[model samples]
Target: MLGQAVALLCLLAGDAGGLAFANAEPAWREKERLLENNKTLPCAASGTCSLGHTRQWTGDIYPLQGLRDCLRARVYRREIILVSENRLVAGFQLYDNMMQMGYDHIVLMSTEENCKRALRAWPQVSCIWSSQVFAATPKYMLDRHAFLPRAARLGVNVLCLDSDSMFLSDIYSHLKAPPLRDMALMALKDPAIGWLNSAVVYVQNARPDGPSVYVLNEVIDRLERWAEAREYMLGRNRKDFCWEQMAMSDILMSAVIGRPIAYGCWNWDRNVTYRDAWEGAHKRYFGYNETGGIGSWHFLKETKVPWPKSLAEHAPGFRRTEGVTHQQVIQIPNTQGVWPEEFGGPLYAPVRGNKSRAWMELIKSDGMPLWADPEDPAQAAANAANRELFTYLPEWIGIAYGQDGTSGYWNPALYRGANGTGTSPYALAHFYRLFGAPMNKLTVKMANNMWNWELSHLLHPRGGVFFASTEHAPIPDVLVYSPEVENREWVSHEEWDKATKALTRLAMEMGRTVVYPAPRCNLTWLGGERNNHLPLEIPMQFKHQCIPYSPSGKGFNDNRCMLGGYLMQGCMAARWYFAGGMFPPEYDHLVVHIRDKAAEHPVATVAAEQLARSWDSEELAKTLMAQHGGLGAGLFHPKIAEKLGAAAVPAVPAAAQKPRVLIIPSVLQLTDKVGPREQLYRDHEREDFNVMSCPWIQNKPFV
Candidate 1:
């Protein structure tokens, strides 16, 4: 008999995958076959079959078999079941929100047509047609009651969710506690009337005879009868619509039988239902507030609003200063010389100042006022004197005016070359004043050392390379840089040197000129080296290229006033430093100093013809020589040197044809500086790629 029962179960379990209540006919036939064979079946101790030992047990086997099949279908697990109808947009938002919280097994119960529409929108969702339950009562009253019996018969643990609710956190994980787990049904207590709110219902499929199904059927039958007498008892013109919650509350409140697992944390009503009780009793259990925490919210009145649009509307505003004068600005001290106390003592002022004091007063005390409103005559004279004095200072210590005409700040634009159109000439003149002689008297060895230093310390650390647009050009046209490499894992010194030399050679061959503009001053690769000392160990013969050209002998190197080598000639190296290596304006005024020079010289009128024609043919020849071993004897093979001069000079593209300006914008924003996203969007507006602010094209609805 046991063998026969096992054979029967194995046969029925084969079709268990298709054994829904809607398709129970095949399962019913299998149950009849088992009974006809007079096979003894497993039954619950309290069930009808156990009540009378003499009576035929055939009638009791069907429900038990149905339960077995339901269990076989693998429905008894953590699952989300939602009742939704025409609320397609709300449903989608709920589904999306659930997905964002990492809940995947979601089931939608609705009419066939509604289910079809929802499946079309989100094909990954599982749907069950439930319009038949709505035939007796209006959808809302029947919707919550309908899934319980069906889910029980299907042998699944279910979390019945309202379509309007948003799950803020993982509520399912909290339900595993012993006290909450022991209960067969769990829901939020309605604060308004002390009734159970059916917004969130957790049904545990533990009963072999399916007690939840029996209770749900009894509630539905009682409600159907109550619908007829409701109008007469209440003295109303029409039948009083019975809510499913009232039926569920009745069953839960009864003393005769089953009790529900009612906990405040599991079902928190957004309407603040039972707030005091929840706070006092279950708040510590859940560790969430009225507005926050918990697993889900019944957005009772929020059915009409879409989730994304609602979130956007309620997004917090950016904090802004009350008044312009109250706005704070940082003041940095001079690194080169003594700064006056009025301008804030030596490092930087910890406290911020208002615009008037930060902009006007600091400049007045710092020497001649560097930036002032042009409309004021005295201010203009101070600005002029500041610009004149900027030429006498180091190239790094210049400033440019802000987009607003009255303000001037630090600018990092590098003077790349005669063909380089973006750099400010005043910045270039200063660069020439410091390193003009060696740059003019170019050497292969000098260029190589400069290239090595720039590559190893700056470019390689940040995953950047100097790339020229023209073929086989020794010097790169622009520095293509990525700020993302700043936080990358530290590389060994040998690995860094190898990557630098390899990328330099590749950039030369590919005619690509680009370098990363790192924004921070503290380089992880440099370890603990002071700013005054060079990080790399240069050979004694190559130290001249590494050392700053301080003709005045006032210890420019001591203060680290000049960025050494011929890379400063075109200001390419200087621009890289300014973009990211320099400290923020609040901590360092180096950019402010650079921008002052840029404002005075302004890119447009600053010796364009002379600068454009000024290329060092001597530097170009030596660079080509160094490429094939003419400069350093042991650096290249003898055969490679023999073949060096035989190669013809690659034709330099006409200056007009060369891309004069190549802007490699920073990908990430600095904490103190204005974000680069907006500027990047504006720059790439005509390009094919999408910027951060633009709508995600793939997710957008079709026209």
Candidate 2:
């Protein structure tokens, strides 16, 4: 027969690792004896079954080790079947660990092909494959076909497991708990996305009526759903892993299983769920008095697969229990530094049950202070001093404040460069005044980079780049994209091509032109020809280019700062791509320069001017060396701020022909001692003349 004999061994264990369950069952014991005494047995059929080694562990800075350990522990207890060439080698390791604890009916299962390979290596074991039982067929379905038949041959009761699983607590007792008389086994119900999680599960092998044909059918149906929705598969973009989990869980939940209670079942993730458990535990364990409970946890590691050399490696004294897991945990020093501490947890009074003053001081000193006091003379002095450091713009190059980042209870006016003066929102009424219409120019800075797509898309419908007559509407005539490269991964090539082409086409429709800096060849290549390359490497440091903001709720992005800088930029960019429409143009003469003095290269000038044309600048100038004798010679000087001072300055108007220009100070925000925003005004009415700062928390974007 093509089908071969299969054996199933079950053992009880306490720790997620199989060591605790080694001698728990007779079947396990039998396996142990085979490993110890049987020298003549086929490598594939005898001894302990071992799997592949997982990657190394680093510190809590990386989570891969914890996840690997958990999975290894869970798989060790089972009579695992492996259809691989190194059956004997694999079997030996599995047997070694299982027998060490005492239980051992470990069997190494493999296919004939694998057996043949094993023969050349250490072939002493028997083998099996679906071809042994099923008639000759294609090999693609071998794994699927082999699974059920192998389980049936193993005596009707089997546990199906994914590679990523582990046992942290004694699961054997629960597994061994009297099987439901009617149902042979029970399995966990999966959770939905935008819903709760459904991970750890229990399964009963036999049902009084029959095998779980219903459950199997449900799996088949969902798999079909997945097949139909192939384009939307989670694996497609390598993003939205949660979607994959959701899809799988949705399928699992489709089954009409009996009331199956869910305990802590972990899968391949560690997010809010894990953080919450630890948070709650830390709170209670430190005397908060709340019942701290965690049914289960998935130790999904970070991208770096290496495991921590030891617990101490993740955090000092992490291995040695510190004071209160809670108190000490507060300043869970970010091993990864992926996000700031504020998002990690609530700010306690730096006090714990023990109330160590030193510890309190340490917690208090975790992150930098976020607020700035305008009244403080030191702060004012600092702001004033920093203002001189800025490279002033030309009189013709109007500075209009774009609503790249604005937040809260009032309408923030755009900075209108024409007629020097601008409207400032100092009171709540300003918000009411500017409501219902789009604000002035939505500056496509790093923070609001996403808005670029929105304008691009909206303007694409009408003349590609013209502003709408409506208030806060878009005037597509001018569009800007800067700080070149960032979050490049999330941008889909298809969407990019569509958007760029749309931008080009829209510019023509509006009877305007487009001026974009040609992307560096290398960057263009990185994204292929389809995507726009906005590299974050140049014009500013990563610190200045990326900022953290809230996501969800009454906060930015979603109120939670769970997603860090890169993702936030990607999401906003995506949203901006779809945000449709341009605002009314409040300015006529808006000059954009592409030159930065430090990087004195012609290529920069060439690229900047090109970019200026992309935005349909009314006029363009190229500064040059004296030898060239063009505007280039006098256009930009070594100390050009002095030369620009001699030119006729535009008079400040009550309301700029353009909306108030809000200088967000993105890349410019850095290279300074303190933040660049003006400290004087709060709302739009306080000062109608432009030049104001929104109530921005340090490192936070306006909602």
lDDT of 1 at 660: 15
> Which ten residues in a row are the worst by lDDT in model 2?
323-332
> Which portions of model 1 miss their true places by more than 4 Å?
1-80, 83-85, 133-136, 208-215, 228-240, 255-703
- Which digits, one per residue and each the tens of the lDDT, describe model 2 over residues 307-410? 21221132211122211100000000111212223222211212222312322232223232221222243443332222100011110111112111122111
RMSD, every candidate, angstroms? 33.2, 29.6
lDDT of each candidate versus the true structure: 0.31, 0.24
lDDT of 1 at 529: 36
Find the candidate with the highest TM-score and give its number. 1
User: TM-score for each prediction?
Assistant: 0.27, 0.22
- Model 1: how far residue 353 lies from native, Å: 82
- Which runs in model 2 stand beyond 4 Å of their true positions? 1-96, 99-112, 119-127, 132-146, 149-155, 162-171, 178-205, 208-213, 217-248, 257-703
